[model samples]
Target: MTAIPLSWWVSVATALFVIGLYATLTRKNAIAVLIGLELMLNSANINFVAFNRYTTPNQVGGQIFAVFVIAIAAAEAAVALAIIIATYRRSATVDVEDIDSMKF
Candidate 1:
């Protein structure tokens, strides 16, 4: 059976990563940063799965690593969300710039 080209998958992943990077860098909200981080993690997973499936159709190593990455991403999201909620409660806002505590 024929499959989609590897380059296509790589391009998709690259696009996702770039979008995520842009969101993380440009957004002032903590929740938006977390969403961007999730996008980046998902992009990496796509690369892992695409390479593993295309390059080593006989082995499942890539899938396994991708699963691990997913688990880590989930945990990271949970922790990050908890922190954001706490910060929002304390400051009444989620803006990263307004939450700065080191201001003299």
Candidate 2:
């Protein structure tokens, strides 16, 4: 098996992050936005793990931060999903444009 270069992994992570950012910026669906957020978070996690693996002496700070990020993302997903549900109940739709009237 051929060994993969660390730069390749880092580049892949950067691509994922950029794509996720684009998706988050252009998508109108709340679920799609959440997916983009997840992709971005995972990309960051990949970077952390890759750096931790490649750097000599095994500095674990990156890995620790990645784990913390994962946990925080999970909590964010739960809370955001709850808010989405509440919004859907009130608006009867999940389209971002449909809820623009904030007078309610």
Candidate 3:
């Protein structure tokens, strides 16, 4: 079997990150932004694994870091969703631009 080069993985990660960036920028809904954030996190995780696999096969540092990122992402998602829900409850809409009650 032919081995895939590191550039391939890096390219994929870069593309995913860019897609996520676009989604985050263009989407107005809070949930859509959350999805974009997830995509970006996943892209970073992919890069971490790819580097670990190519650089140091024996050590599991990359995998460990990815796990930590996953944990942080989960927490962040929960907190963000809770805040979004609270905002929706107050403002009646999930649009990030529409919910501007916080502005003083």
Q: Which predicted model would earn the best TM-score?
A: 3
- Badly placed stretches (over 4 Å) of model 2 are none
Candidate 3: tens digits of C-alpha lDDT, residues 1-104: 12899999999999999999999999999999999999999999999999999899889999999999999999999999999999899878999999876686
Residue 7 alpha-carbon offset, candidate 3, angstroms: 0.6
Please report, in order, the local distance difference test score of every candidate based on alpha carbons: 0.93, 0.88, 0.94
Ranking by TM-score: 3, 1, 2
Q: Which of the two, 2 or 3, has more lDDT?
A: 3
What is the Cα-based lDDT of residue 19 in candidate 2? 95
How far does residue 1 in candidate 2 sit from its true spot (Å)?
A: 11
Model 2, 1-104: lDDT tens digits are 12988889989999999999998988888878899999999999999888887883357888898999999999999998887899999988777767688957
The local lDDT score (0 to 100) that residue 19 gets in candidate 1 is 99
Model 1 gets an lDDT of 0.93
lDDT of 2: 0.88
How high is each candidate's TM-score? Answer: 0.94, 0.87, 0.95
- The C-alpha stretches of model 1 lying farther than 4 A from their native spots are none
What's model 3's lDDT at 85?
95
In candidate 2, list every pair of residues with a backbone clash.
Answer: none
